[model samples]
Target: MYRFLFAIDKEISYSDLKTLLKKGSGIVVDVRSKDEVDKGRISGSIHIPVENVESDMSLDSAEFKSKFGVAKPSLDSSELIFHCQLGRRGAAATEKARSLGFKNSRNYAGGYKEWSEKEGK
Candidate 1:
């Protein structure tokens, strides 16, 4: 039951994402499917597929806390960063998150592909 005042399509750079990871200021969510995630993912990112993001974000859902080792985000949570194998799904996931009251949601434009390639993972 929250309204967003910020742009829903906002995106974050790979560098900025890395910075956030270092400081641990945001919740990094991998919106890829389980199979894709099994292949690899950013260190410390929570695996919440785009299809199940909304449900998992619910405070009543224990999956979020059990999987991510943190409580579900409230309407005024700090930041929720979403990424996928590429940028497309991440962008869509960000939109979904915004619609669900996560106004701080952002998409990592350069997704796992760019991240792995750049980091040589």
Candidate 2:
């Protein structure tokens, strides 16, 4: 169990993710491929493959909602947490998000593998 009392700049641990999910305090962005995501994913996560993250983020609110079924996150929101099957692509997405002015974006370093194994998902 972990208690996160501050914003994570770039990386987040599995425990931190669990805490965030429990609190419903962040957006968990799944940057995995469509096939990978279809197999399994963290419930309530929004999917946007790593390659499309930048363009998707640029979509206007209505277009974004129409495409993703969720409102577009503001560029400055600190709750954009990106993850993939493993951490590599997630790190890339985190970099892209930060480059696009999402300064508080973070990556789940332990990834879905850790999440599924630990959470029995």
- Please tell me which predicted candidate would have the highest lDDT against the true structure: 2
Q: Please give the TM-score that candidate 2 achieves against the real structure.
A: 0.88
lDDT values for all models: 0.84, 0.89
Error of 1 at 48 (Å): 0.9
TM-score of 1: 0.84
Clashing pairs in 2: none
Counting clashing residue pairs in each candidate, in order, gives 0, 0
RMSD of 1: 4.2
lDDT of 2 at 57: 84
lDDT of 2 at 29: 92
